[model samples]
Target: MSNQHAKPPITTTNAGAPASSDEYSLTVGPGGPNLLQDTYLNEKLAHFVRERIPDRVYHVKGGGAFGYFEVTADVSQWTKAAFLNNVGKRTPLFLRFSIVAADEGAPDTDRDVRGVAIKFYTEEGNYDIVGNNTPIFFVRDPMKFPDFIHSQLRLPDTGMRSNNMQWDFWSLTPESAHQVTYLMGDRGTPRTWRHMNGYASSTYMWVNAAGERFWVKYHFKAEQGVQNFNDAEAKAMFVEDLDYHRRDLWNAIARKDYPAWRLEMQIMPFEDAANYRFNPFDLTKVWPHKDYPLIPIGRMVLDRNPDNFFAQVTQVAFEVSNFVPGIGPSPDRMVLGRLFAYGDSARYRNGPNYAQLPINRPINEVHNYNRDGPMRFHHSGNQPVYAPNSYGGPRADPQRYGDPSWFVEAAEIMRTANVAHKDDNDFIQPGTLYREVMSPTDRDHLVSNIVGHMSQGVESFIQERAVKSYWSPVDADLGARVAKGLGLTITA
Candidate 1:
């Protein structure tokens, strides 16, 4: 085992100068009046009135709460992350739930994909899981993200959203079958944020204490149990309460009816991924439970609501790039893209010192070269900022701390599709979802939802293409039923 105390005692300040007893403010001898001669006084006062930065673009309408994630089962063999090392360990966390594509004033009952983001304040650093309410996503590649969101947003000519635009994009992109199926089903309109499961939809890499790696996916099953509204009920909810989900979450916590979720992981041995039945990293697919069953590791309960909505809820940021030791990203293209997009979004919304925000700040002390932004507060007194200088400064300690990364093949860079594995067809799992997973009542609701949404102003050509090319490939009956609902004939 590597030595935890590999680095020598901190002999220099973060600014790279000799350390000193600067913990106290300069004052007149013992109990005399304080003097301005102490330059430390000025520095202390400045940090006291620390300025705040501006904040957001997406997940606009949301609610969140403070919670603690308690490890239920020991997972030390799967990950070396300190928070997951010991059973009964409780790590403070903040979870935010949101409705994607909805504006700040939009009704929470709208049928849309829900965003689930969790930030774990671990001993090492902040580990974030920025995911969605569903296990699969609409597109595998990040290149199609903006286009997909645009299709869901309001049209340019008239500031009103069009279902035709959505169906057109989904029909053109066949890879979206699985997530589209989930969306057009009863799951789309969750009864409340507390009644839906959350998934870290992208595959990730986890390293054990032995340095062995594995491919992993995260699922947070709502202990409240999954509940949702059918198409008509969801529509009626809009008229009943615009903020139904948000209100329910707040009131539940306030009344001591805490919402909880059980954390489960589907882990695949690292070497198995190369020859897996399908691309394990595909955002549009799921690794069947039969192959790698879920291992329940922890339980998260949201027992405390945020005091201020704007500061703790709206301003709270979750960067997908935030990874603690023993856990890192995978080859999933969407995950790779998000590693940059999410953090950059935070910097743009909240200034470069966004991480310094109270909600985003880690529980442990942060010592790094990151300095001098809009609302800069902390300054390493008298220490040089740069590293590798004669002046002592914090340096990388790979021997003591493992990098949250894996060995990558040095392949030639080029734009192409992800490598395909056996049984990699996009429609396979969604077809299984329709045929096997969904109950008879669930299937009826799915078909009805699809028909209800697609029948609204979709072009005849798009309707035919969706039924024949998209839904039919997923399942013949599904395609035919959707077509029958649209009063259209399926080709081929």
Candidate 2:
């Protein structure tokens, strides 16, 4: 065994001056009001006042830790990504778990999608895998994302969340049935951040050295094992500790009981995607594991908690567009939307120099003509900012890294509805899931849970719409059972 833990000596300000004292703030007249003339006091107070930055619009409540990703199995045949090119390769990483659609003060145990963002500091660059716990999402198209979020958020008039508005959007968007079923189930309420599984629901592209592209989906199976709270249990946990999930994660790491997850990937050949039964790139669907078996790629263990929560967790940005040379995005519409939205939101919240932050900065050397933004920290070293200049500066190197090229067949370009497949009838998968995937006890609990939440809304029509959507997906009997539990009759 090796002892890799050694603390660095404490230093003073940016000028590298040694500090005599750090404990007491400089004050006037022995506990009188602090003097404005004190440089250290002014620096500390001014920074403290502005320490808090803007909160993220989504995934506001988050927890993070330092970790390493160790490759367990070879995946070089599928992807030319250097991080996963060989077995036994370990890359430093940071993991952030967050609650989607919640305020910073919101309870961690709320019934919301959990975000799992992994920043892999690779030799190529920082590669980020941003995903949720569920394998599917509510909307397939990116254009509908804003509308969907608006519907799920607080009502414009009342400034309160409305179940009616949520159901109204879900009922109208039939494509949301698959993800909605998973969200309504017990898995929606994870016990803690450590116990939940993370998934890359969107299909991505992995190109090998030979220039062969493969569609890939990522899964992080929790080594702690999946554990969820029932509706009652989740509510109780919230009241007891609003930061239950965050606390659990912090305590686990503090005790040296590091939590881990196995990285698994489902890969499909490029040609198969075009002729596949379902649209492989759809966000609202899942690739059957039977057809595309999960291949073990790596393992990630979170070992160290952040020393400064705000610096490491709150300001840390993960963007889908932050891809290295080999790993790239697929044509998944939702992913295409996110590649733009995530980076744009980070720029808005943290400024254009968000990438310069320590937590988000890449371990590899960065050279580009990107100069002069808000809070520009780096000096380009007298090198000409413009390319093809007389002075030596970073020049475009195509041989070192070639651009990604994937085959795209002829298709009409228009803002029409999604192309429906022969198997595109929305209800079949959710129906099978309800009948086959769930056990008898699980089915009973599912019905009970649905009825409990549905009973709270005031609008009768909205309730009817909700019931109909559920019934249409599963059997009529299951729907009737929920209706009976809610003291309502189902009509033909």
Candidate 3:
């Protein structure tokens, strides 16, 4: 036999035990039933069967890369975050880009919102900005989030997604109009992940060194410039390549054509939120640039592709509640809901010690009383497991590091809609977007996209109601155009 056909002298092993023959299972005779003593075969099959972990409930079809965030302008006055303090300071970060409303098997070019989650390994801890490509969302309150996602997913009986269900939910929830407007436009079908922008759609609180608080929104403007596929183009690309966006990102980084984004923040003074014309914390609405202009603070460049896709990309998790010093959650209902949900999801999917995973671990040492669970690779080594011990365990330092919190008004815990501000109606901002922000071409595309989606498998009553309640409220022209396209007539 040729030298290439010969096996190496080194023995192959299953776990730590040497396997005598990998190609054949141990048996009583040549053709006898494979014996139960074939422990190596059992081990191989067991490992293979248990390989896959639970996929994320959302944003499952995605890819990620390693990068660094460099502070370009001084932001110390607004935030005391160590990662964003000094000019030219660089903090390592990982960015995951994903398509919402789809599983891992779905096409990347689907007309869906993209998830843009970033994890910054700061000196303090892991800071994550769990956001999406769009600046706003379908619902303001967390109570309606599950319903909205359910509407987007397949129906229980038919197991097929229905536009009627989606329209019905949107028509019932007026606040969804703003996000619906954005979705049924060029912005929904971004040409590639590299060509789209990301927004920390939820409002967050930034505290300065002097304990002054501010409400802030994060925007990651793509340096490549925003580009998108029209409805027809998006459909065509789905047939061309299901993983087009993932491939584009990987190829670009491999060839040293790194993607970058500038970090711009819209910061409202803590007191200004109380008297703003509209609710500043509303997730379904955006703070007009005129009211609070974007202030550039830093830039992020994804220069390194993951060496192992599963180890770094799939295993990496970003929790919305993972805030370091100087940052905390705002009063946004969705943000508050996600503060618990994201971390809980990670723990359930990745085990109780998910933070101990290399991708999720912070650069700094973790010294805490929390002890072992499944896959607890990191141990404290006889350290006290409870706090307030005299054996020199880690102690809380209230003097040096203050809690990132603020004062709240004392009120009765009654379930009610958010306290409204002047000009807080759902239709105003969306109407403004349709009339003032969108260009003529964009307006046409938006109308077409809406008509195309609503005309597919939607009931006539749902269609009429959507045209009258949602589209008309957004803009009269948009409503009329959509109605005309859908062959429906509405009374003035």
lDDT of each: 0.88, 0.84, 0.90
Runs of candidate 2 exceeding 4 Å displacement: 1-49
* Residue lDDT tens for model 3, 129-244: 99999999988888888888899888899898888999999999999999888889999999999999999999999988988898999999999999999999999998999999
Tens digits of per-residue lDDT, candidate 1, 1-492, equal: 348879756555445655454576566778887778655556557766854434344578899999999999988888898899999999999999998989888889888999999999999999999999999999999999989988988899999989999999999998999998999889999999999999999999898898888899999999989999988899998898999999999999999999999999999998998888888889999989989999999999999999888778866889888998889999899998888998888878777887888999998988777679788888887776887767777778887576656667999988887756977788999999999999999999999999988878998998999999999999999989898998986656
Q: How should the candidates be ordered by lDDT, best one leading? A: 3, 1, 2
Work out the TM-score per prediction.
0.88, 0.91, 0.96
Backbone clash pairs for candidate 2 read none
What's the count of clashing pairs in each model shown? 5, 0, 0
Query: Which candidate model has the greater TM-score, 1 or 2?
Result: 2
Q: Write the per-residue lDDT of candidate 2 for residues 1-492, one digit (tens) a residue.
A: 235697656657546766555787667778798767667656666778987777776788889999999999978888888988889999999999998877888889888889999999999899999999998888889889999888777888888887778878887888887777777788879998899999988999898888888999999999999999988899898789999999999999999999999999999998897778878888888888899999888999999999989889988999999898888988888888898899989898889999999999999888898888899898778878887888888787788677766767799888855555656656777777788897886778778877777777747787776677656556676788877887776575
Model 3, clash count?
0
TM-score computed on alpha carbons, candidate 1: 0.88
Q: What is candidate 1's CA lDDT for residue 355?
A: 85
In model 3, which range of ten residues has the least summed lDDT? 8-17
Ranking by TM-score: 3, 2, 1
lDDT of 2: 0.84
Model 1 lDDT at residue 381: 78
